[model samples]
Target: MEYTLDMAVLAILIAFCVNIVLCPVFIPFLTKIKFGQNIREDGPNSHLKKAGTPTMGGIIIIISFIISSFFFLQDNFEAKLVVFSTLGFGLIGFLDDYIKVVQKRNLGLRAYQKIILQFAVSIAMIYFIVQYGDYEKMHIPFTDKMLDLGGLYIPFLLFIIIGTANAVNLTDGLDGLASGVTALVSTFFIFVSWAVGSGTLPVAGAATGSLLGFLLFNAHPAKVFMGDTGSLALGGFVVSMAIILKLPLFLPIIGLIYVVEVLSVIIQVGYFKATKGKRFFRMAPIHHHFELKGMEETRIVTLFYVITAILCLVGYLGTAGIF
Candidate 1:
């Protein structure tokens, strides 16, 4: 256990050092390539000035994880699968970002197109886990019970991979919001992995370190945006990590902020259509509602960070004795 923790820590330091060194040179290069994010016209008015910031920063993040995986998780088959699935999702996000930025269009890949790609990736990942990885049962949180999904696990896994990948995407609105929350969630994954001596520790550590480094420039009054590339990659990696640990059922509890963000958008959209455009929150994503209610972006981000920490604690407690 101690050795695994030490290894996780080493992976984190390596990822952070690599990412920090890459950011300064990377941001300028992105600017030169004109790979700037297109701010949605309908978004918060205060974000107007942030238009054209360098986006697609997920490239560096994925690079860091690739490097981290080779160094710290080379022998772990499950970890490799998680890392590769994340890379696959990163590619999808990269295509989406490319269309939006390079193509100079607000709408990137059409929604169905992205979903189809996501489903393809999800199915591939689920097949790998079921065929290669040993765990086929989910550990019920807060109980000494297991539920075998049998063949149904395929669809269940698909729902989780797609839902969580997009859920984190929706939470990317405010500066540092997605990165900070993801960093915290990744940190929780490290603890959980450590508690069980799981092979997932290295990738989780890599994720934590990369997101923390990204947040240096992504915080309030940001200089760059993560775009879909970062968010979806994050969503992919996070959900994969949870599934790799066989804790997919606990993902919503561990990542409640993401759940709320997605739910808020769904509810807002459904209600708007039902009521013929009568609104609930000032915006779809819940974070935007607080923003419209006069909460500073930094404050909203900070509060979400705190909430994520507490939820992770609950999740950790619930699963502590399972291993």
Candidate 2:
């Protein structure tokens, strides 16, 4: 309750430790349950080998976050809200992942189905945020002033919650990309939350620690993939931190990688439709375009990390004065 060291470093360590231990045990169990990933044949040929790697590893991050953040839970209401929202999205993702497992193939929930579920959660997130959120103003980048959105904040908040969740989901195509970038983004959120004296610090800590730990297996030649489950829930967690800090506007700058990932797909598809079957890139998500150009998976992932780190730094510096 006093913002002790355990609430900071120890919580991270605990989360990291938990994931490191649980992953090996969990991966085998998922395999036993036939919960393997199905690679898309139309995608990179190099990714075919990734097929059947145990999927749905998000449970590990969720469990690890809960265990580590539990220490500070009683004192932090906002942190509790984050945990709940994460679990809600996790369930939606789990259902999607489970459908893929049942079909023994890559195809899972239909796009409409997933969007409906996500929108349901987004609406709920907005209701809670509007009811209990601490501030009416958001810090505008490169300005010393905070912008007041008033009731308009509700619709804007809905876009952030739903859009960001799906954006991160699309970014999950590469191993270590989503989790690794999320770790960096969460690290920034943790600091930014502290800067604002937010009650959401514990959830931020959990996010940072669990994703770092998840990278132990989620890295190159990943032993396990977090699937839609981790990406969506993580997206929710990250944006929720912004809501609690009233920094939702800064999220696009901080979460620039997610923006790019989703945009690449939209651009690729929209162009193909307009051109009657031409591509703007060799593949969508941009990472795959790099992959098709012969860039190694690890290299592409690392590059993304660097870019995300730079954008996060920019977002931090820009918002520093207003906060």
Candidate 3:
């Protein structure tokens, strides 16, 4: 079955429509259920105003993707794999969000617990890919060379999934930061998936469309926060797509902002420990540093969006052999 651009556009439109229509209904329901966000006391003062916003709004995007995917994707192995993996990772995020919402605490899953769960889920996903698919060969973007990892593919796959999932989580410090960036990354993934002639492109396209729709409600002064639910799930979904397409290396290019966000935290922590509280930035995650430096939140987010868009174009060009 040949995938066409028209189908992709249609899928995106459906997802966008679904999300815009559903967000209003879901946001109010979440607030009614007392699932409001808990702001960190140490966070930027501007975030205090967002404290009571509805949380777990990722449920809206998840539901919209599932419904839209079912309607838009054709019956194919790759499509099924993408859909199932997305929901499976989303379930893990949902569990974490549930704990936070029920306990009314900012702390959800402990670090060790989250890591263990991520490992378990990532391993399962890799095993499924290896057993049911032919992805033993890895491809490097902008080149036709392939690296056959054979038995070592497991470890490599683990790194891609875990790294991407955490990078996105780290980038979620600011309002709409993760959602907007994720939508951009997913849009690139759709292009790459199509260029690679993969049957899963339609599903990726639909996911991108769904995210764009979600972003309308998820941007600054957001009516709802995606929390761990959206960030982790989106990270997992995009990473899995790259893995299935054998293009994991392109993630660093497509998700450059997320990488910067994660690296800022890592550097800050390392420096603080080495110097007994010395710091590289006013705050970690880089975004907060800009806020501390007196940059408006809206400006910082928009700048990041522009950077994300540029990187996404570079990724597509690299994948298309135009770079």
Candidate 1 lDDT over residue span 1-323, tens digit each: 23388888888888888888889989999999989877767778888888878999888888877787788665787788878788888889999999989887678999899989998999889878878897778889998787798888888888989999999989999999999999988998898888888888888988888888888888888777888888999999999888888898898898999999999999999999999989888997999899888888889999999999999999988785486
Error of 3 at 45 (Å): 0.8
Question: Which candidate's TM-score is highest?
Answer: 1
Clashing pairs in 1: none
Q: TM-scores, in order shown? A: 0.97, 0.96, 0.95
Q: After superposition, how far is residue 150 of candidate 1 from its true place, in Å?
A: 2.6
Candidate 1 C-alpha error for residue 120, in Å: 0.9
TM-score of candidate 3 on Cα atoms, chains taken together: 0.95
Q: Which ten residues in a row have the lowest lDDT in candidate 2?
A: 1-10
* C-alpha lDDT score of every prediction, in listed order: 0.87, 0.85, 0.82
- Please report the TM-score between candidate 1 and the true structure: 0.97
Off by over 4 Å in 3: 72-74, 321-323
Model 3, range 133-230, lDDT digits (tens) per residue?
Answer: 99878777777677787777888888878888888878887778888888888878777666667777777878888888888888887888887888
The clash count for each model shown is: 0, 0, 0
| Alpha carbon deviation, residue 122, candidate 3 (Å) | 0.7
Off by over 4 Å in 2: 1-6
Candidate 3: 10-residue stretch with minimal lDDT: 314-323
